[model samples]
Target: MNTQPTHRPVALCALIFAFLITTAAADKPTNVVLILSDDQAWTDYGFMGHPDIKTPHLDQLARESAVFRRGYVPTALCRPSLVTLLTGHYASTHGVTGNDPSPKYAPRDSEVYNQRRAKLISYLDRFETVPEALGKLGYLSHQSGKLWEGSYQNCGFTHGMTRGFPEKGGRHGDDGLKIGREGMQPINEFLDLVKEEDKPFFIWYAPFLPHTPHNPPQRLMDKYSSPDRPITVAKYYAMCDWFDETCGQLLGMIDDKGMRDNTLVVYVTDNGWIQDPKKNGYAPRSKQTPYEGGIRTPIMYRLPGKIKPTERTELVSSIDIVPTILAAAGASIPRDLPGLNLMPNLTSGDPIERDTIYGESFAHDIADVDDPEASLLFRWAIQGNYKLLLTYDGEVNRYQSTHPRTEKRPQLFDLIADPTEQTNIAAEHPDIVKRLANKINAWYPVKKRKVLTTFQ
Candidate 1:
């Protein structure tokens, strides 16, 4: 008959609820959405000083995010650049060097310069991705649009609506053309599906727009098309605006589903904008070369409560994305991966731990070379504000130390002073040049063919 005793159980339950609320508030899962644009320029947005490109969504995202003022891609090409982004390793290390058709896809390895054999080896195989690692920690991993080369199915997506891009599929890889709403529609639908799911998700989206064959809806094209403005510029801006609208749509879904505050939204491009091939005197080597116009890209990371709106001049690379996402999700980053966690920067507005970053492009011009495409390699290291680029040609098995002809003397630039990389400071700072060169030379061979080919 002690009815008062029941009050003790109610009080205990209330105390437990308070404790759980405090814990949940202290440790919330950071939902991640990485939006990647193909061939988007670093300075093409309103925030980055484009005179006319309309990117309202990106500009808004920049205001709400930590915008990396000096974001560079490790590779200029999509397949290799993306490989570096996901795996946080260089193409040389990942072994997906050039977009050459591997032996399996080639008429003859010799005929195609033996680029096909390397295509058979995927860069994705070399390391565990952040999403995959997140999945290991009980997070839902979903991706729409471009994930990676031929094997989108095996790129470790829990639920993927990615259509096979040309990079995948062949006798060795799939060559099927992807026309018509490949990833966008599916992305919208996928967002609807996961709105009610109770688990955290990491959505890796790479939209195909503002790339080659610049096509936009007729209405979008008409919105920007005019008689007085530059035709190509108008078209490019139109494409970019349409892409930005798509971003708004995705973000709208998050807001509509009541997930904005809990989500960490990031937007980036695979590489710098491809200088218009149709426009003369725009920039030499639209892509496939390591230039500001080829490597620097737009990056926006908005982790609502975590990252404050600020411009971070500290240089960050695509390599940092892997560790950043893993750290945000409270997932484990594999010891072997070369990426550094960006939690400190995102949460506290601190600089990146890495002072220097490396970039590589293998066999970019191998088709013209007589020897094996695998024999050609390029290496670079950026330290402080200086960068050194080295090119290697000829046999991979016969690398020598003093091949002066093969090794172009290092070209160094003070990035802070000349963001355009127009000045070569290697001759002025001989000591710095020698130090960086030696470091690059020593670290260069670590990503040898043998190391790349070794599969776990």
Candidate 2:
């Protein structure tokens, strides 16, 4: 036999090694980054066709994403909406229908309030959260900002900044709120650790930006402020710009780490906000109401070479987020989840099978921790071009003083014609109203529902 090895065997061995490396890379789990904008209107973004507000990074994201302009959360409040995103369950199903427990039950700073809050947080134990589900797949998750439901550990986050509720300065985010406002150090550190360990990561980056305190940098304020634009409006717009800058920083960091190709980024707003022209607060029909400005947001998912970028006008919900994420991760989706897996729609360009999406709006304060209907204010359904909002009898709560339900009737709008929801065509289209009302009832079957106006 010849001493020299055959060239054919050497070539075969090289090909085998290459094949193994490709397979391993393909099998690597994708990193997920959930970016939640707090209290941003659907129409405020540059990509969404706002006249003045500039969100360059988000516009870029929208271009790279499967943007759904008609996305709506089940509830139009921060806590419940965030809970829905985490669990893929509606506010009613998750039993966290409000931001806080009823103040009537206990004073805000009293031990009783803390106890009630603890009880409210306990509701999360009933369902599997996005982080909890991903944890089983060896994903290291970090909770950075706007976490209301107790600690990051309680929510299955491996590392996080929230100290949990009842802790000092722990109502919403606590120290976690510092992520975007102060700097990106916490997230940067977490990303570095993930790279070192060679493990998949999930980041919950729900910064309390563009929500309140409308205090942007002087440069941004100056850029937005004008003679016609009220100071309040200018401040709000500037806050949006600030939020976009933070998002740009985050995406840039990911790109710098060379992880953009393997990371899946999802963007959504917790709820919508319309700043008052004359005041420093949210205007009516937005934030805590069932109107479009309150409930609607531009939901986007960007995964390079995975999800095709396209604008979808069909109705989608925040409920679909968990299933979509799980499906992308090759994990088992819980059969009981009411939301649809959006992978097909996103990747294959298939239409969402369902024709209608439903939502429930509850009081700002939880009337009962166990009963979601106790705080139920409105149950709305969007079917095709028509939207039906059925008002229910419930406590308005102390917080809704600025914007209370003035019309105690079943309001129906042709969304195609009246996107602003200025006109109610319930009487004109009783048949459509009844059809949507029936659909809502079939979905929720609320026993405590006291409809202000019947469709008869």
Candidate 3:
């Protein structure tokens, strides 16, 4: 009887301690899932005022989330865009200016050596990413599909489901399965794997639909047959629907694991679609250009503890994402980050004051095409509604009477008045044009390489 009493007291104490530990863990750990869509146009989604795109899952997610109406990306293309998103740095610093010039596609060993001098530079893996930073805080980090600028795995992801899109000998095709097949596999697997584990986890899902090939499932492809819309519009709509289906599937898994309330679900696009001017009837420039259609993206925040179901028009860029995620999880924002923690805007009911947003790019055609090295310099800066595009098409020698060909280009736009970017108001608002030009020149130093231009 004496021995039994001693054992009972010890058992009660152990049980009490176990309960306290579990409660503490639950309070601190919060799962974060960032779903990144590839090159999706703003108007392609039904929620964003699209005429006829079936995005039920996206619509449902947005209905219960805070939407950022004026979200933008730092660059128009993939490699630079993803780098800026992870590091919160602009292209000039990150150095991933163009697509991956994979050596596998080199015509010959000598060709690789010859092209090395002119090869586009990519961002190194040393720059810390949100996932890696979260891992430092003892959070499990996992990513699938389109992780970073290059194959170097220094971004600090604990696990990767997919390396990226399926590339077979540099051949390009319209296979939807090839695009998102691997990136999504881990998302589905994690949904099931997390049923027992209560530890906080971070997962990134980048779907490759609606990007280029425009190849969606046949079932979704059958939904749109409007001849009035662009021929590619039907295919584009199909990709959007298919992407939404994946979102629904991921959400279902969250619900099944009973992690919806404790998880933060963020939906955003890598960049806007490469719209064709003749068909899209919206913008003149495509993805490789510094236009709103290429840079402006959609951002959806879904966290009951943080976000209110409302739309905010304040301009926010991709660089702000890392800080925002850290803030959401009660983690500290790193001192080196250029972005501000957005959790206050989401949770405190106070609006964030942002008057200016910046976007930049180097010539994209350099790597893929036989373009002149002199034309590879370009940049832009936007403040409020004013925008200035600076194109550096080689240097102009006074003796040769050479100058930038696009110097004849126009600037200045009242985004509120002409959101479509149709008319050039630079001549009418010379003051605004000069002001914007001066700001751009002040913000970015003029580069005098093989080419250079300063609009101011």
Candidate 4:
């Protein structure tokens, strides 16, 4: 009899119900599936005007998403570039300039390298990463492949494939490299868990597909094989298609789960790779060089009901991924992050925040993350259609040991008119070169400072 008469209990029940509803809504902002292809060129996809290679799934995804055809990364190598994507900071800021170590420390020889590597991976903890940011806001995340930053837990993922134990024969993504290459069971299981838990999730699908060891199933390879195209080229093309097929399956799962309306799909490459024309290897200028083929990539964001699908030519950077994902999930972005949130541009065709984007091309051997110019090979700036590449060839340039094919002079390219960068107009237009050089210097100061071997 007193159950209906108790007014306080009824009001408390209402408040509790409202709290539950709010918490439930907070856990369902927008699921993010960031698919990163390793060592793929900007022009490799059918949508990006690749004449031979077929990336039908990616092509369709491009059509359905807001595509940035001229997106660029901070570095041309995988480790540094992927770091920028996760942390929303440049290689200069993050202090992870190279793939592994400078020739000084062998990984297994001494704990010196292991200690250094641990220090490098720990730098990720300094900044709030995309997954870490989303994880704070009730999002479960799974790291699938190509992650170099120690462990999945170190980066704040709820669950991941990489243990990242240096003592236990773990270098970088030891068993995690087999996501798309082997199977999708791990990803599928994670999705099922997320479904059962009723929470938003971030999926890092950075598969090491088409990177190296150009091995593909014969069934896929036969599709591109021909007398005109070299077998290497055919195999590379098949690998691209194989990667595309995996993407199709992943996307299909999203649709089947009825999560398309709420899920956000993002696509970008860690760096670019161009298979050599003659030999079965990578071309010099395509990867690890300060060229469009190395640094340029297509940035795509797809949310069915949130963002409209369209192509954008305005320049953007891989660094923007962190801020964009944070903003989408209603999370806080760190103030020092150099990247702009592309939410306005994603929802509407808003103008980009900045006019120019600057980057560095460092040697594979990182002299010091604290010093950009120490291991620096080239300093580049892109403002509008004009891009300037300043190559360092003296004592400062560590890459000189490898005999870089890049010219030892400042080169300028009007990307709109000379997208291929065949002709250098640096001498023809000295004023433009001077202006761009000054702009780059202003963006990233080139003054010398004290050297430190640790991350700043």
Candidate 5:
């Protein structure tokens, strides 16, 4: 009908309404769900192209998220790496190296061991954690699985099941570590509470699956275990699948709640675990050693609407995760934190800036609780497809390292060319070694470059 006059006004009103809705949606508070896998191998995921592993959920997540294949953690050990993730500081910067001091403390000295463990737990009080930061802005946060930072309250989790207090036998997560292995009830309950409360939320789902106690469910074990397969390998493989299922349960909870679009899920392993070829144990190079397997992990950030899904080749670090989450949540990030805010890069689909990432292998116990540099067994730096590892002769609190250098020379690997790290081309390229060594020392200076154990 004769509607020319009405059409323009109606269109204008519709545009205004759409703009308001978009603006409101954009300004809505964001929630964060950080999935830190514990003691998992960098190569064990189907997404990472592992032949034996069947991590369908993680694979799907990788497809839908911005995946960085070259992601790394600063330390190979669990406690320190977890601390770094919490504080957005390296083990050295945070001054909490290794899991326990028993390796350094006197043998049979249970008294000293207990004391040192308590000291390490209390040490985290000095730094501001991610949860505490978000909680201040009224974000409800939950902690489950592998929480070494004292009690959940000690780490600023408003709600958590684990009691990490060392005195109460809460070393490295206690009952909290049972989250994934048992069920994701605590996490799902926390999610329910957050929804009911109508508040922004943060979740730390750092489960201890595929870690130790590699006792997978019977069906998972049946799939991997057989007379031909090594028992240890089968169990470990089964554990990986179990962990993947646990991850699916958690993600499914999010989807069931209809909060997937607004929630940001960040994934990274605390450190790599290489199952020993012969035994039910981890190999040196894979776990506590300064090798590709120790430091290498995939970093994924998924926010369906905000960040596009793309596989990124550029080197990214675990250090960047906290800053990225904070940015996504519209929270103010600490200026002094070293990690780059990867949100802009992920959203714009731009190449991540810069090269060098640092790592250290340290005593299972602190060499000196106050000195991170002294505690280090090895210091490494990665840049432009090259990785250099250096060992120093002495630090005041240094102890004998199980993964000591046998040859007193720098070990350099071209990670791009040799992903498995089968060959060390350090002799072939001394200049590259020198450059990377210099970078490592610049970040964490080496007092003496004697390469203590002549490790090759």
Candidate 6:
């Protein structure tokens, strides 16, 4: 009896060891994966009540994520919109208001065009990107698809596939475009390296699927095509299905690697698209305009055991993504970011405090590389249920023939009453229009922009 160890001391030692183990687990860094859709309409997903399109994987993701049905990007174009996500700033603030520099420097073979393109890519140097900020915490980032800001290295990615602009055929994605379309080899290889190193990882998976050249697998084409639906529409629909399948594969890989619990996955689209029924191109008032069909998307955040799945109707912007990811990784957020940290909103189900959100649309080609306001087309504001779209005089550039803006006046719509924006109540609701217009101007005062109507 005297030789036996005391039971109380052994029990106390076991409790202390268990506490240390739990603390270490809690302190482990989280992995991040950002899935960006190329050109998808806000209404095209199965979870969004689409009658025909079957996005089963995205539907499952919606169920598991904190889904914001009324999410939007500040600009409706691809390059500038993607830049906004990277910098956590509006297109106005970041000085990347358009996809390409002014068409005046065009022909694609000129030295002036190359110089301007190089200048456009240089804009990323000024702002601190998500990958750059995460690197301070010993995290590794990989850039895979749809990179416009030069190479992955330029964007603070440890590993990437984009050769970057100034390289031949390196304008948008170059070799990086093959991530989802060709295969997921690059992503899998990067994941393998991350596992070997045992480090936290960040992946930018912006595939060029369903954007254009709507070529889907034969099986998917057979499923979506029908006599009632045009071949053009069917092709677009099948592309959506294919995009969803790729997403499922990516997510399934994470689950297979046993990284789902420690991964924070976010989903959004670069911009919106409405496929033409008669043609293969995008229809008017979509992709490059300030309409709901152009700017709206379903933003989602999923972190197993951390973020509770809930649908939020309050307006959220892609700008909030960077700050949210930063907060989730326990990194210090930059004070200059205009968006809110959505950690509380995601984890505790707290409603976003701000009621008013602002957006600015610009020409496809930059009128002035130094001045973001030079290419301004529309500066819109959504306050409560009323949305006000104030048009500005600017060149439509490349999209002039395909998607022209004919409205030259302030258009106001009660989104709750008429979601499709069929009727304009600007004349009837002068008070509301003036209020929203002032709010928009105050948010981003453009001295050179020519306002079609005076709010005062």
The total of clashing pairs for model 2 equals 0
Arranged by lDDT with the best first, the candidates are 2, 6, 5, 4, 1, 3
Q: Candidate 3, residues 281-332: lDDT per residue as tens digits? A: 2233646556677777778788875578888777777778888888877777
lDDT of 5 by residue, 1-456 (tens): 875555778899999999999998788788999998888888899988898989999998999999998899988888888998898988877878887664545542377666676777887888788899898888999999888878999999999978876547677888888898888998888889989988899999999888989899999999997788889899999999999998999999999998898899999999899898698788767776678778889999999987999989899889888888888888899898999999899999988788888887787766556566556678888898888877655332332444656655777788888988888788888778777776766775555334522233
- The root-mean-square deviation over C-alpha atoms between each candidate and the true structure, in angstroms, is 6.9, 2.4, 6.8, 6.5, 2.8, 2.0
- Taking the tens digit of each residue's C-alpha lDDT, what string does model 6 give over 1-456? 599767998899999999999888788899999999999999999999999999999999999999999899889999999998888999888888888887665766588877888888888889999999999999999998898989889999999999987788888899998878898988888888998999999999999987887988899999988889999999999999989999998998899888898999999999999999998889877898889988989999999888999898789999999999999998999999999899988888878899998898999889778877778889899988899999887766677763455667789999889888999888888888888988987886778767855433
Candidate 6 or 1, higher TM-score: 6
Report the error of model 4 at residue 289, Å: 1.0
Clashes of each: 12, 0, 0, 0, 7, 0
Native-referenced Cα lDDT, model 1? 0.66
**Residue 167 accuracy (lDDT) in model 6:** 83
- Name the runs in model 1 displaced over 4 angstroms: 1-19, 25-28, 102-105, 108-123, 163-183, 226-229, 277-282, 364-377, 394-407, 446-456
TM-scores, one per candidate? 0.81, 0.96, 0.80, 0.89, 0.93, 0.96
Query: On lDDT, who's better, 5 or 6?
Result: 6
Q: What RMSD value applies to candidate 5? A: 2.8
Give the per-residue Cα lDDT of candidate 3 at 305. Answer: 56
What ordering of candidates by TM-score runs from best to worst? 6, 2, 5, 4, 1, 3
Candidate 3, residue 213: the lDDT equals 65
**How does residue 105 of candidate 5 score in lDDT?**
51
Query: Quick one: RMSD of model 3?
Result: 6.8
Displacement of residue 312 (Cα, Å) in model 6 is: 1.3
Question: Which TM-score value belongs to model 1?
Answer: 0.81
